[model samples]
Target: MKQPGIFISFEGIDGAGKSSHIEALAAAFRGQGRVVTLTREPGGTPLAEKLRTLVLNDAMDPLTEALLVFAARRDHLQQVIEPALARGEVVVCDRFTDATFAYQGGGRGFDLAVLSNLELWVQAVPTLEGDFVRNPDLTLWFDLAPAVAAERLASARVPDRFESQPAEFFRRVADGYAQRAAHAPSRFARIDAALERDAVWQQISQVLVQRGWLGAAA
Candidate 1:
C-alpha cells in the first residue's frame, strides 16, 4: 500500500483567526524539517482561485454557491493537495469540505441530504483520483461567538462577502462546527477563539504533540 502523509485542515467561521494559525502551524512543521505544503480550499489552484473570487464576490442562489465551492474543491484536490500528499508532504489546508457543510449547509440552510448527495457526486468526479479520497487527518475548529467574532471583523479594515453574513448565520455556522466536533471528537479539536492568540497556539501545539505529529517529526 502506498502511504500518504497527514492532511490537517483549519476550520472556523469568518474572523476566527484560522488563517493566521494555519500559517503558524505550517511554519512550525517546516521548522521541524518536515516538508509541508500550505494551501486553502475553494482557491488553491489557478482555476479554482478564479472560481473562488466569483463565489465570494458575486451573490448567487444558495445551491449555486454550494456547487461552486465543490467545483473549486475538486480542482484544488487535483492540482495541489493530492500531488503534495503523494510526495509524502504534510498538507495543511486553511479549509475543506467541512466549511461547505457548515457554511452552506448549516448557515445558509441547505439540507444535509442535498450536501451528502453533492459530496457523492464530487467523489465520482474524474479529476479526483480514487486513491486520493482520504479526508483530513485532523480538523481544528476555532469556536467563536457570533457577537465576539463580529466585533473582531468590525475592527478589521475590510470584510469579505462571507464575513459580512448576518449574525444569525454565523451563529448557525458556529453550532455546525460544534455539532461536528461532538460527532467526531477524535478527529476534531475544538479551540476557544476568545482566548489570547498565544494561548490558542499553545492549545494547538498541545494537540499536535498529543497526536504524535511532533514526536514523529522529532
Candidate 2:
C-alpha cells in the first residue's frame, strides 16, 4: 500500500496546555522508529516564522490577520509539511488551519465565509490521494473552560496579541473549536484538559493507540 505518512495537529487556546504534550507524542512515535517532524504552524519555515512573528505581535485588522495566517500556512505546507509527508514522516504540528478559524474567525469576530474562502485556497494541495485540501488526519483539541484557561495563563509569561485578549475572547475561541469539531466529528479528539496531568496524558495516549498510531504498550 502507498503510505503518505500521518499528520497530527494539536490545538487549543493559549493556556490549554496542548503544547506540553507535543514533544512527548513525538517521542512516542520516534520510539516506534517513525520519523516525526515536530513543528508548528505560522512557522516550520523561515518565511512563515517571520509571518508568525508579525501575527503574534503586530496590531492588525482581522482580515489582514487572516490573510497573513493563510499566507504563512501556504509557505508552511509547501516547504515543510507536504514534503515531510511525502517522505513518509509523521508530521506533528502544534497548530494548523483550525487555529485560524478559532482565533481570527471566532476571537476577532471575522466573517467565517471569507476565512472559508481563504482556507479553500491555501489548503488545496496535490497529495498521493490526488488533489485535495490538506488537513490533519487527527486533531487533538485540548478543551478547557475559558475561566480555567485564563487562570492557567495568568502568570505564565508576558502575553502576546492573542494571549493578552480577555477571557471572553477565549470563550469565543473555544466555541469555535466546538463548532469545528462538530463539523468534522471523525477528525477531532477532544481532550479534557481540566484533568490531572497524568490523566490528560493517558487520554491522549489512549486515543493514539485506538487510532493505531501508537502501540498498545505506549
Candidate 3:
C-alpha cells in the first residue's frame, strides 16, 4: 500500500527492554502531532491475536508455526497496519516478520527460502518500478547477549513456550537478528541493551533525533 506514514519496528530477544520503550516513543511522536498506531505482531487484529496465542503457547512443528505467523501477519497488515499507514499515521509495531525469521527460521531451523516466499506473497506491493517488498522503514534492534537476556527473563514472569527454550535457541535467535541487521544496515539501528535502561533510551532517542522523528530535546 502506498502512503506517507513511517513504519518502525522494535526488535530484540525477550527481556531486552524494547517493550518498555515503545510507549515513550509513541508519546514522543504524538507530541509532534503525528497520529501514531502502536501495535504488535502475531496480533494486531482480533483474529491475529488469537493466532498469536497459538503460535506462542501451542505445540507445533516448525513449518506449522511459521505458516501460522504469516497468516496472522497477512490479517494484521490488512486490518491494522496498512489502513493506519494509508491514513498517514506512524505505525510502531512491537515486532514484525523479522521475528519469524529469527524464531522459526533461525531458532527452529526452518528454511529461509520458505520464509522468503511467504514474505513475498504476503507483503509485496506492486509499484511502477517493480514489486516492492514492504519492510520496516526503521528497525530498532535492542542488541543484547543471549546470556544477559536469559538472566533478565528469569526474574520477569512465567516463561512461555518460546521463552522457556534453552540458551542455545536464544543464541541462534540473536545471531539471526545480527545477520538481518548486517544484510540491511541502512534500515537497522542497533542499540546495546546490556546498558542501563536510561542509557538504552538515550540511544533510541538519538536515533529518533537523527531521523527527524523527534526534536533534539525529545
Candidate 4:
C-alpha cells in the first residue's frame, strides 16, 4: 500500500455534532477535488460494526470493553483506514484511539499504561503489515460542556449507553480531551462547541482556510 497525504479525526462528547461536521468537511474536501474517505472507529467494516454495537451496548466489562474497542480499531485500520490512506485518499475518521483513552482510560479510570500496551500489540498484528502509523494528522476536538451536551442529547430520540452515562463521567472525558489537546497543540484544533451552529462552522472554516485546506474563494 502507499502512504496517505492526510488523516484527520473528529472527536467530541456525545451530541457535539461531529457526525454532521464530518459530513460537511468531507464535502468541502471533495469540492477541492480531493478523494476523501469517511469512516468511524468501532466500525467501517462488517465485523467492526458488530463490535461497535457490543461496545456501545450495556453488557460488557471494562477490560473486555477496552479490548473490544481496540480489536475493532485494528481491523478498521487494516481493512478500511490503511487501505484508503494507502490509496492517497484523505481519511476523515469520526472517532479514533483518543476515544478509548478518554472514555475507558480516563472516564472509567483504567490504567493508561495498559492502553499503550494494547495499542502496541494491535499495531504489531501481521495483517497490519508494518504500517508506520502515528496518531492522526489532525484531531478536531469539538469542545463543549457536559451539561450542554447532555441537554442536546436529551432532545434526540435514542440515547446510547455512553450518552446515558452520568454528567460527571462525560465531564471527565471532556477534561481528558482538553488535557490531550494541551499536550499536542500542533495536532489538535479545539473548537468551541458552545457557540451557535454557524459560529462553530465559521470557526472551523477559518481553521481550514488558514491551514490551506479551504480556498480563499470558498
TM-score of each candidate structure, all chains considered together: 0.91, 0.97, 0.96, 0.92
Error of 4 at 132 (Å): 3.4
lDDT computed for candidate 2: 0.92
Off by over 4 Å in 1: 1-3, 124-133, 216-218
Instruction: For model 2, state the Cα shift of residue 142 in Å.
Output: 0.2
lDDT of 3 by residue, 35-56 (tens): 9999998899999999999998
Candidates' RMSD to native: 2.9, 1.4, 1.9, 2.7
Evaluate candidate 1 by giving its C-alpha RMSD to the native, one decimal: 2.9
Question: What local lDDT does model 1 show for residue 200?
Answer: 92
Model 2, residue 11: C-alpha shift (Å):
0.5
- The list of candidate 2 runs beyond 4 A from truth reads 1-3, 127-130
- Candidate 4 residue 58 Cα shift, in angstroms, is 3.6
- Tell me the tens digit of each residue's lDDT in model 1 across 69-135: 9899888887887788778899999988888888998899888788877777674434444433446
Cα-based lDDT for every prediction: 0.84, 0.92, 0.92, 0.84
Clashes of 3: 0
TM-score of 2: 0.97
Ranking of all candidate structures by their TM-score, best first: 2, 3, 4, 1
Clashing pairs in 1: none
